[model samples]
Every structure is written in structure tokens, then in C-alpha cells.
Target chain A: MTGNVRLTQVARRWDAIIIGSGAGGGVVAWSLAFQGMEVLVIERGHHVPFSPPDRDHLRNHRLTQYGHNVGPSLDDRRGMTTGDDPTSATWHSPLEWQYNNNAMGVGGGTSVYGAQAWRFKPEDFRMASIYGVPEGSSLADWPISYADLEPHYIEMERELGVAGGRGGTQTWPMPPTAPTVKGQRLAAAAGRLGWDTQAVPLAVNSVPYNDRPACVNCQHCVGFACPVDAKNGSQNTFLPRAMETGNVTLITDAQVVHIESAGEKVTGVRVVQRGKSMVIPTDRVIVAAGAIETARLLLVSQIGNQNDQVGRNLQGHYYASAAGITPESVYDGVGPGPSVATTRWSHGNDGIIGGGMLADDFVLLPIIYAKRALPPHAPTWGDEWKNFVRDNYRRTLQVMGPIQDIPSPTSRVLVSPTETDAVGMPRVVLSGTAHPESVRAQTFLLGKAKQWLAEAGAEQIWGSPSGQYLSAGQHQAGTCRMGEDPRTSVVDPSGKIHGYANIWVADTSVHVTNGGFNPFLTAMATAIRTSSLIS
Target chain B: MPIDAHLVPILRAATARIVPTDDLPGAAELRATEFILGFPEYADSYNAGLAKLPADFDLSTPDAQDSALSQLSSDDPHFFDLLRRQTIEAVLAQPSALWDAMGFVVTA
Candidate 1:
């Protein structure tokens, strides 16, 4: 185990082999190791430590190009075309797609997420119970209820050092020492508007907890590494702790190709590392690659093909924002994530047709913000535009909302026949559209944002134009949904894949419905629950 | 003291509009222009670009200020853009108390 052992050398079987190192796999590895079970964790991304002494900010930014820094230019991987018409871009070509927000590293999406850890409201788990599914919607109730996962949410909050007050005036188990000033401002604004805005419960530390340092307010938390180890990503919390157990082994840079199964049971997994492909035996296996890749992995492996539920029901949230030039400066470079949030639109009430949360804009550097500017009735370049940037670069503020997408059976991830990745795996083909309800939600939130800016004393407000092609945000969920019925679901209540006792899924893919709030907290909670069940 | 030699008056105007004078000193006293101009990330290109300016032009005067900005604006919009952008960024990058005076929270 100590040397650079190939898969051939490590032919001995293991108790468990986890396919990801994010929230789900990290939790399972820790729990199994604690139970004295041998666990081997395979992560496709590298283990990047926080603020390495010789860290080149430029190089790191390049590696993480989907973020604000100059990096490998990302092509939209969403709309892949199938036919070989000369004009059509290949379905697998990375060059054709638009913007990609998903992060690919050891911590998965959690490493660069905004860390808005919100639990799915009680109504979310029972979607069929509350709102009857409309025609053309694949909505259904989750196998497990929020009540069943409540304690696990609490456990996740405690373990991840989530800082916020609790729901409905109920006190948090561990209260934050002090709310960030941005959170305070948002709370004040929400109070004035008569909307229930709460301090966003974040999986980031306000004070040193569980051996991690307190947040230093670098104002670069979202989409960037915490120079100080305060954010509760898997790398910062679970994975390292799991390694300390001595019962768990982590193999980085190992890309799993497929599961080598005998009939129904997975005997081992075939993986490629450094130009060699080999199989490592295991008694059980878990796939936690994430919503998009998890489904792609299953389709590639040809496992769970009977029901064809593995890669269906793709869902992701769409974000819309309205910004304006205020008479005053609202740019205070402190923490980087959204600190305050309003759940007024979280339910389809108040004349709003869909669900969402209104929150302040994440902190943006001037260069980043300039690129995002879209002034009404102005050319993208020229003297007027230069003047516009000069005049309003500092005097602008934004209010944004994330609209929840209704899961659709037709929207899915399929293997692209035309293209392949660096490792020869078929490229992931993503096909989906913004749900109509989600579009309506964006419209309502944009109007609300305009009103909020006016109330905040903005001189000239500019609302985003209504559009159909709303892109995905940090919230991507519900591909391999959970349900009591095996026909419609991929996993059971405890996240074990249907028809396979030892195969499990521990990622956002298991989300039955995309919750109104950020989904990271729910992911962590699910991980904790899955671990408890395995124990 | 006279305005810092590297500080453009337009930059001063933009910074004043962003965080106007109050109990706290404005961007001028903070030496924001000097900071942006001197930072290594921009120094080489900025110096070479600014070398095109006339040797004895008094940018403090309104006409000179307009002329200099217009010329710089046309040659490289990004440079002039950075001038306005960096001023606000420098002001926002200051301590939290300064930000609070300018109607902004330290976090969010």
C-alpha cells in the first residue's frame, strides 16, 4: 500500500471502494473507517491543499478556469448535437458548449461552491403530497421525508461548522459568534421589505471549530480556495480526517472506467492510472461522481440499465439578477459568499408561480464584474461603453435569485458517440431546458430585485431581460432521483442503488427534487444519513 | 501637497463619487492612484503606455484632464477602464470601517 503499487499489485479485495471524494464518498469513507472496515477512495481530481506556500495564484486559477481567473477556456458542454452535418458541432466536442460552472477537483463542487448549506424544506420531500404533478413534469415524492433526515441535517451542520441561526426562530444548535456585516445589511433590507430574510446558514466557520481556523474574510470564498482553512469542504473536513484513521486508503488520479461485475454483483472496478488499465477487487462499490458525471459513469458502465433510470431526470437551477448604478458605493470586499437570503419566493405563494431565494450578489473583483456588465441600449464596445465602465464600476449593486428546476424524464446525460475525453471515455452529452415554472420564477425575482434596488436608493436600475435560455448555477441536482418505487427511481431511501445491495449513490444525483435553497447542505446531510445507514 | 504626479484627476473624480469625503480621508489621501500605478501586475505595460503622454501637460487643469483621458480612452479602452475600475477597487479593498462610511457592509 505504501509504494506506487499498480492495480495488479493491489489485487487483494477490499471491503468497500468509493468512486468519489466529495461530500458523499468522504462521509462514507470516514464512517466505514471508523467502523474498522477497509475502504479505498478513488478521486479523479487532484488533492489540492489550501494556500500552498509556493502556490502560483495564476496557475491555480488556470486549473480552475470555470472560475474568475484566466484558465483553460471552458466551452458550454450542454447543447451537444448528434448528426454529422458539416456545420454542426459534435455532441462530444467541448468547444461547442457555452459556460460550465461545475468544478472538477478532489472536493468536487463543494471546493468552489458558495457554501449556502440549506436543508430542503419539509414540503420539498413530499412534492407529490403538496403540489400534484402537472402534465409533462416528472415530479414525485422522495422515499424519505424531511423528518427522517432532520437529525442528520443537524449532525452535518455540527460536523461542517455551519454558522447561522435556525429556522422559524428556533435557535441553532451552535449559534454563530457574530453575523457578517453583509448578512446584517441583508437582514435589515429584508426586515424593511417585510420579507423573512435570515442569516444564511453557511458551511463555513465564523470561529475556529473542529481544528479548522476561523474565516479571515478574504472575500474570495465562492469559486476560490480559502487562503485560511475555514470553509467546510470535503478536503478540509472529512477526507483528511478519514486518512488519519489508517484503515482508509485514498488513490488520486485514478479514473474509473467501468464496474467489472459478475451477473448482478460488482466484483471489482476497472480503472486507468498513468496509461495502464487494471481492476481492483472490492466487496462493495459506491458511485458519487456527482449528478452529471455520476449518470454518465453509470451509462458507461452499463450498470442499472434495466429501468434506464440511472441517467434520466436531469435538473439544475437557473439564476437571474438585476443590477443598477446606485448613488452610493455598495462594494465592501469582505467575505465572498452570499451572507443573507430571503425565502419569500421559496414557495409558490405571493402571486409567484415558482420557488426561489433572493440573495445579495457574491463578491466580485473589478475585472470580473466588468465582464459581467450588460447595460441597456448600449454597444458591448466603444467610447460609450468605456465611459459606462468608468462611471459605474464602483457604484453598482445586484440582487439575484436562484429558480428551482422541475425534474424532467426527457432531460438526461447520454454518452456522446462522436467524441471522447482525454482518457477515451465518451464525452457526456447534456440535454435539458429551463422549466416554464422556473422561467416564471426568474421573472418574478427580477421584478422583486428591481424593487429592492429602488428601495435601497438606486438612481438608475436596470433589470435583466426576460429570456428562455437561462443557464445553470451552483445548484445542480436530481438526475438519479430517490423514490420508493424502483421503476421511477435510481436509489432507495438510504441511497443504495435499486437491485444492487452493495452499490450506493451519495451525491446530488439522489436528490428527488431541487430544493428552493442552495443544495450543498442537503448533500452533506444526505451523506451523513447514508453513512449512518451503512454503519 | 499637490496631487500625486501619477494620479489622474478623472480617477480622483470617480473615486470621490464612489466614496465621497466625510470624516474619513478620501481616496486621495489613501494614495490609491499611486498604489494601482505601482503594482507590479500593471507597472510595465502602464509605464510604457503612459510614456506617450506629453512631458509638461498639466493634467490638474480640466481641459488637460479631458484631453488626456480622451486620448488614453481611444488608444486603449482597457487602460482607461482600469483607471476608473482600480480606483473603486482600491477604495473597496480598504478596511471595513471605511467601507461602512461609504454605505457598504464589510461582508456579503
Candidate 2:
């Protein structure tokens, strides 16, 4: 890679240009590069290593500023003109959004994710076929099914070194490490409730597999970078491997402005690198900027919008935390990620209509824990508040329910009419309401959390505010949904864009619905599947 | 072991709360108080807020102590908030064996 290869000069032409070096783009780039294709990956964020992990609690105050972070505002789209417009969706930092949804960086959201690699249950792909669409919902079956993607899931797990137990009712492919004290407590409590609890299958190393160190059980795993190279992210996994192949060229801090297309075919992409705008032509352009950003980019580029489905069908895994203060500090210095999981709440039974996982909530850092201790009745300031923070920071144990939100046409990313980002691109305008069923599902899960916490000997407990404006959990999905009909979907079953033969989308944006679990594994699996086809 | 005079009171208070004198190897003996007080100033958000302190101001003086403490207590709720939070986190990050002997988490 040349130090000064100008984007304008590169506009001459290339074999492939993959936009966004996150889950999907990174995988596709690696596959294509290994196939001897000249590939260029343009990422808007800076490239930084996870060395000297930022464990300082104060630095982790806000969710959005967690890692090497950059992205367009959600309000930059056409539908929402001003922040005052009641219809406009509020935008938060993409990094911050990951705490609820996905993380971003050179590795994309995979950098800070819990790396709970679970294959989409066969039911997840055929949701509409199995459950039938409920009234007033856009629920539909995935263009492809679990059987079609199962091999790719295995490939990604092996490549990424996913660790967990295999084939219970859930079909976790890897076995888990022994439970920590907190995990044991959660298991005991869950058993008393007759709920199915198991050690969470994680992507972190268990016993020095793949030359990465085994997890030290630092209890700071979820949102913080692993000090040891145990947690598998693209930077430590695919991207490095791709680079070693000497075929992939990664250009960080190059924000793609738009995809220039002639009629049905994409000609090239316009990007801003080092404050200069230039166009880089390529034979094929893959949009994997993530669900929210990818949709916003397509909308901005005027690609895949003939049917107006590019930025439409947005979905996020909505989450709520139910917490309580126990007499003992169950928040003992255990590993940070959820150590145990309950799939009991994952599937609806006996006339129930929604599902979610009740997992050990361990994402809390010092600042967030202190802030959460402030109850509705507690004063925002003063000695009483200080004391409350001091006492409850260690005593609190929370259960986070990441429930699925039904897809809606109204839930979308459009360009805000008035707001422009640093590069003059229109900000993403998010619209939509929290699906009522989602709110109900979250409430049900909160009750389950209360039960667990109470059984674990909590003296006081509280539920999260209901129907809070759901933030983009970086688990954003369904923007460029995959469907058999080109008129209704942006990409085909093979992840190839309908009109452009060479172009493809391998991100979560192709998802028809956000699954009940975290979307990272699915995203990785989808990327692997797309790469197999593209190869 | 003698405690650092500058951090004696703060350490005394922290250890008193974390593991009282009646409990095994309280914060002072574990050097947890020193660990907390001597935590790199760079990691403290409070230091960032005080970046513009007057050139002539002597941080060691009694008046400066009162002024600094008052400012931290009044204008910066986030500072005290972080202080208490980090102190507890430090205590928790210590070896589980220490906390186990103190009867926090029972070990088999």
C-alpha cells in the first residue's frame, strides 16, 4: 500500500472496493483478497490497537466515546428537518449505542462485544412461516434459512475461535468455562425458578486456543478491550489474517460520501480522506457500513432506492435492565460479560407471544453503576445521593433483557433536511416507535429479573422506565432487507444486490428481523456466508 | 506499616469502610488505601477539571486545602461521585482471597 495513493488517482479502477471494515465488510474483504482479488476497504473511523486497554472507569463514562469512534449523526437524513420536530429520531454516538447494541472500530462492533456466538435458530429464518405474521407487522421469512447458513456459521466459529458447549436444546457449538461465583449464584437462583440456565457460550479463549491467551476472568470483558488478546475481533482475527495474505488494502479515516452509479451499476465511491474529496472507481462495491449507517449511505448515494426499501424496515434489539441491591456485593469482581444465560425466556410458550434471554447483566462500570443507583425518588445531588451511590455501586446486580423489536416501515433512516455532518453529508433521520409487543416483552423479562434478584436475596429492586426512546443498539437491522422479490428487498439470498451483479451487502442491514440474541454472531455468520458465495 | 502522612486520613476512612479494624487485614494493611489515594492522577477526572488552577496557588497550603476540598465537594459532584466509585472498585479488584477472608464471598 502506498503512503500517498491519492483517492482521485485510484478512481481509475479496481477489482473490488468494500466500504466499512466492520463485520460484514471485513469478512468479504478477507475472502475476496484470499481469492486473489484486488480489494480496498474504506473505513471512516481511525485504526487503533486494543493495547493498554482503557480500563480507567472515568474514561468510559459515556457509551458513545468508548473506542476509536466516528459516524454520521442519525438526524442527518431527509425526513427529519430539525431536532425540535417531534417526529425525528434522536441520535446518540454510535460507540455509545453499542452498549445497548454493537461496538465499532477497526474490528467494528466486534471489538467490544461479548462475542456470544449463537447460530440463528432454524425458526429465526422462517419467522413468518412458523409464527405467521401478526396483524400490522412486517414480519417475513428470511430469503435464506439456517440449513443454508449452518456451514458458514461453523466456518466463522472455527476461524474466530468461538468457545462454548455444543448441542443442548440451544445447539451452542463450543463449551463454556466453569462459572464464576456470580455465575453460580445466578445459576442457583434460576434453578429455583425452574428456568433453564447454562454457562454462556462466549468467543473469548478458554484454554489458550489459536495462540491467544486464555481469559483471565477480569470481569471487565463486555465493553472494555481485553488486555490480553483473548477476545476475537476482526482486528485480531480476520483483518490481520487478510493483511497477511497481502491482497487486502485497509484505508482508515476515509469517510465514504456516496456511491456513484450509472443506471443500475455502481461505478465508484466518493470518499473524503485527509480533508480532500476524491472518487475511487471499482468493478464491484460492497456496502457493509452496518445496518443504520449502511442504510443511511444507500439513501445518500441514491442506490437501491427504486423501491424505496433502502432505508426502510429498520429494527434494533431493544434492551431494558432490571436491577436490585442485595445485602452481599454480588457484583463481586467477576468477569464483565454475562457469565450465565437463560433461554427459558427465549421462546414464548403457553399462549405467550414474545421471547428474550434472561442473562447475568455484567456490563456495569463504576460510573454507570453509580448513576443507576439514583432512583426516581433519590435526589440528583446532595449527601443522600452520594451515600446511595457509595452503598449501591457494589451491591447492585442487574439482568439485561435484549428483546426483539418487530420491524416496521416507519422505523427508518432518512436524511434530515436541515442537519449536515462534518463532511456536509445529510445527517441520518431516525423515525419510528417502540413496538408495543417489544415493550410487553421487556416488561415480562423485567419481572423475571425481579424474581431472580429477589431469590438471590435482594432487599430492594427497581425496573427500568418503560417505553423509553429506544436508542440504535448498533444492532440496527432490516434497512436493506434480503428477500426473494427484488421490488421488496435490497439484496438477494446470495447477498448480491439485485440490479448490480457484482455489488453485495453482507451486514446486519440484510436481516429481516433482529433475532432474540445479540446480532454479532449472526452478522459474522452472514458475512461468512456471503464470502462463500462471492468467492 | 506506616501510612503516608498526606493520605493518612483518607486511607483511614477508606479502610474503615472497606474492611473495618475488627475484620481481617483492612485496607491499610492490604495497602488498598495507598493504592486508591496514589492512583495515578492522570486517571482522575477531577484533575482534568482542575487543569486551570492559578499559577500562584499552593496546593499544600491550609487555605488551598479548604478551597480545593470545598470546590470538589460543591461544584463537582462528579468528582466525589467518581472518588467513592473508584475506591469501591479498587477494593473489589483486590485478590478475592482478601475479601473472602473478610467474609465477602465464601470460598470452598
Candidate 3:
């Protein structure tokens, strides 16, 4: 039976109620459900159909001009203020870049993501201990180390059917997919620079795993749904498995409005389903909404902020990208273009604070390439622009990395004092920029990317500098950080919210320091560890 | 709002100016006007923007049309930018002769 149940049909009380159904919440739901507990997972958006998938070139997640594939829609609005200037506040739709949204559907970002499942290095867990705290930053070491989550990472990788090179006990269940011509070329260049390259770990299938088909190597791999259902996400893996246990109920298009609490204990959650509001009772409440919304939910409920630590220290990866024109045609129109990566710059770079891993970018659709990968002096339109695109479409290559940003407490999400969304809910106001050390780290990574491209026999190289804008977007994390002290953090090492027994956070919201690579795998591993400790 | 039938030619001419024909097919050859009309919001914006073009824009020379577009870009940047972006998107969306010439393969 489909777990998509109507509110009237579900039980009045659930053993555990999980908010949001992305990487974090999905894992928690599966963990708790397999333990014979009734789990209710509420998502704010509906399930997007896999068949007749959205193929609009202009409106897909890659380029949201008209709109995005998965949506909070234009009805959702956020107030954006830059650098502590309330007067600079401007309202933007989720379609706009300033809104910095992940997908809003039942699978959340996992539904439309590229499925890059990277594990953070051991140094990532000890950012403060390894590099010392940068001035004017809120950088801290995670209470739980990498060794604590290593076993969970291996388990989640197998569950998600990840494909990568084999290692010791942390081996991938599936072999890495064949490298594309661009990936091979970039790997050779990294070799010349005395750096080792490895196949990027991806939560996608090389052969049929968990009964899903292998990748067909289609051009439309990233930012779009897989036609073959090959890209494994929480939507296909954990959520369905949890449903099969008959203990997990999924309610889509259910917007959680408030948390009903009695002093220090969370009693239930108030949700708006199809325009009607109702409170569903639960013994335990696990908030796994993405970083921004998770904090906004607590702020609006006027709980979980006893120490005023609900929505501070917002941080996300700042990507440094460089593009160049290879001497020969490097792009062979292969799918899932990002197959090679170098972790040489991920850590231990001389004179740099925390660095990041460099990898070949995902397949670029024609429109995205034309807009983002064109030469610096190329025209935006007309015959010259069209001609340039036709000539370089097959020879252009780009390398980018997501630098580990130094978290600043000032870069935060707050309930706007004067703005509200279409539903009359308090709008979230994002303010402040990243720490200066983050920019230095990004610049260093950009230099390495350019060097890699130049070594690959490229001509006419150009790069984009990381801007001073707030860095919380697809990989957003570190809003409600976990620590032993309630005065400095929102949750404990086990993801239990401080001062509350039954309320917990199992998402990136509990991250003290998001790693230098994609954070989804880390988020899932932590989710499993957190759910295991739940009584 | 529906695009006025009389201004349809103006919309086609504007898209052509953005992606003019060289050795390969351009926006007009790829049926960009039809694709643009499929998007109701984009079509309405095109309807309003195309109505402001000079009456002889559809009959103008290639150079004259380019000049007019450059003027429109300065006069109404938002409309011109929307038209330009949509034209490129429409041309790329279809598996037209341009994709073949550029070696961009679309697969299932």
C-alpha cells in the first residue's frame, strides 16, 4: 500500500513525528520504523512523478528562469537583508537565486540532486583543533568524531547503493561507473601536478542494485530526474523501505506550522494540510527540516530558543569554478560528467585555513553552458554569442570545488520583523556574509582549479571569484549546531535538543562544521547514529 | 493574455535577431515562436514587448533589425533580456539542426 495517506486516515498518535523528508529525516524514519515504532513523516511538497519527468530547459532546477522543477512555488517568499542592513531587505521568490532553496517535495533536495555522496575526512570533525578558530568566526569541533560515524557511513552507502572504488571495510557495494573522456583527461592533468585522482563516490547505480536499473549514460543526468530510476536518493531507497515495514506513514503537502509544547517537553506538532490546520499528537518530535526552515520553525513556535541559539552560525559551501577551452574535443556527451576528483587540496594545504576537494563538474546542459561557461569576453547574445557556443560546446571543460566556509554567527536566519509569506507565516530574513578566511580558502581552491585546467592543455582560461554573499544554499548547514553546552548549541552530540527530552534534530541543522565535500552522506550517517540512540 | 495574431511576425523577427542564421539553423528555423507561445507567461510578455516595436520591424533588413534590437535592449532591458533568454532556451530545447551541427546529442 502507498504510504501517502490522508490526515483523517492516519492514527491520532504516532510514536515519532518527523518533519521534512530529505536526507536526514528519511534515514531517521527508516531507522525508527524498522525498530517497530509508528513513524509519521510530514513533507511540505508533493511527490513529483518519475514518468513524464520535467524536461524544460529554462525552468528546470539547473536554470530556474520561469520556475523550478520541484517547488515551494512563488507563493513562498523570503526577506533577504545584506550585511546587517535592515533597510537593504528585499523580498524574493524561491525561484530567485537569493532565496537559495533546496527542493521542497517529499524527497526534498535528494529528489533532484546530482547524488554526489562524498565522505568528509577525519580532519573535518576537528576544525577547531586542527586549524584553530579563525578570528570573528564561530568554528568549533564536532563533539562526535569521524570514527563514531564511520560505521554508519558504510551502512548508509550500501543502503543508498553508492558506486565508487573499493576500499577496506568501507568498500562500496557497486563498482564505479566507467569514466568519461573529460574525467580521464582531468585525471591525467592532476597526475601531472603530482596529485592523485579517484572516482567520485556517487549514490548512483553502475549495475542494478536494490532492483533499480543501471545508469543509461544520458545527457540529462544532473538537475533532472532519472528516466531509468537509476539515481538513488532517499525517495527511492530509505523512504520506500521504511514504508514496507508498515510502520511509516508519509503525508505530503503537509506544512508544519508550530510545535505544541508543555514547558520543556514537546507534545505534538501543528500542521496545515490542504488549508486546514490540526495538531497531531506524538511522543517524540524530530525536526529534520533543512537548516533555514528548521531554525525558522523553532523561532516561529517560540520554543527551542531558551538560550537564543536556534538560528545562529549559518554556513554553506562556497564553490570556486574555473572553465577553459581544451585544445581538442574533451566533452563526449556522456552522462554524469563528474567522475574524477582530487582530494589533495581537501586538507593540509600550506598557509590555508580549511581547503576543499576539486572535482570535474557535472554534465552541463546547452543552456547552462551558454550562460555560465562562456569565455570572459564572449557576448551575451547575437550571432557572435551563438557562433561561440556552437564552436566550444564540445571542447569546453570546467572544474569546481565547494570550499569549507568559516562559519560566522552573524550570518544567520531570523524571522523577519516586518515581512510575511503568502500563508501569513513569518518570513525568514537571511543576513550577513561569510568570514574573510572563507574567501581566502576559495581563492586558493580557484587557483588550483585553474592550474589543473591549464595542465590539461587548455587555452583561454577564465574563472569566477567567490562573491561576498551569504553561502547557505543547496549544501546549507550549521544553523542549530550540536555541543555539550546548551548556551552555545541547540542540540547535543546525539542530536537531542538541549533542555528537551523528546525533541531532537537529525539534519544538517545539528552540524557544528559542514565538511569540505557534499554534506548529504555525512548528514545520513549522523541521522542513523542519532536515531540509534533514541529511546 | 493571448498574443495578438498581427504581432506574431514581430516576435519571430526578434527571436531571429537574437539567434540569427549562419551555416546552421537559427531560432526561427527551430520554431522558437511556437515554443515561446507554449509558455503563457512568456508569450504574454512577448505580446506586450513586440507591440512596442516599429511597425516595419518585420519588413526591416537584418542589420536594421539588429540595430532596432540594440535600441530595445537599452530602452526596455527587462523585456529584451527575457526575449533573448527565452529565444536561446527555445532553440536549445528542441533537437533542431543546430544541435546536430554543434554535436550536442539528446538521449532517453
Against the true structure, candidate 1 reaches a TM-score of 0.78
lDDT of 3 by residue, A370-481 (tens): 7788888988788998888888888998999888889998988888767766555677888778899899999999999999999988898999676787887668898889
lDDT of 3 by residue, B9-68 (tens): 898888998998888888888888887888786667777788778989999998999999
Which segments of model 3 are wrong by more than 4 Å? A1-4, A83-88, A167-170, B1-8, B34-55, B71-79
Candidate 3 or 1, higher lDDT: 3
Tens digit per residue, CA lDDT, model 2, A426-464 = 776666655566777777777777888888777788877
lDDT of 1 by residue, A1-535 (tens): 2324356655579998999888777877878888888888887766555664222222233123112331112432443433222124333223221323455567776766677777778887876667777666788888888898898888777777788766565455445434444456556766788888776677778777887787777655666666677778887777877878888788867789888777768889988877888888999888888787788788888877679787677777766688777775555566654667787777766644457777776665443454465457543332344355545655676778666666677666677666666677766766655556667777777787777767766668787644654233345677788877889988888888778767888888899887777787788788778877763
Interface RMSD for all numbered candidates: 8.5, 8.1, 1.4
TM-score ranking, best first: 3, 2, 1
What are the runs in model 2 whose C-alpha is more than 4 Å off?
Answer: A1-12, A56-62, A65-104, A167-178, A350-352, A373-387, A468-471, B1-108
Which of the two candidates, 2 or 3, achieves a greater TM-score against the reference?
Answer: 3
Leading candidate by DockQ = 3
In the predicted model 3, the residue pairs found to clash are: none
Query: TM-score of each candidate?
Result: 0.78, 0.78, 0.95
Per-residue lDDT of candidate 2, residues B1-108 (tens digit): 233444445434433443333324434455655665555542445344333233333324545543554565576666655554545554444454444432333221
Residue A219, candidate 3: alpha-carbon lDDT: 80
Provide the overall lDDT of each model, using Cα atoms, as 2-decimal numbers.
Answer: 0.66, 0.67, 0.85
Tell me how each candidate scores on DockQ against the true complex: 0.06, 0.06, 0.64
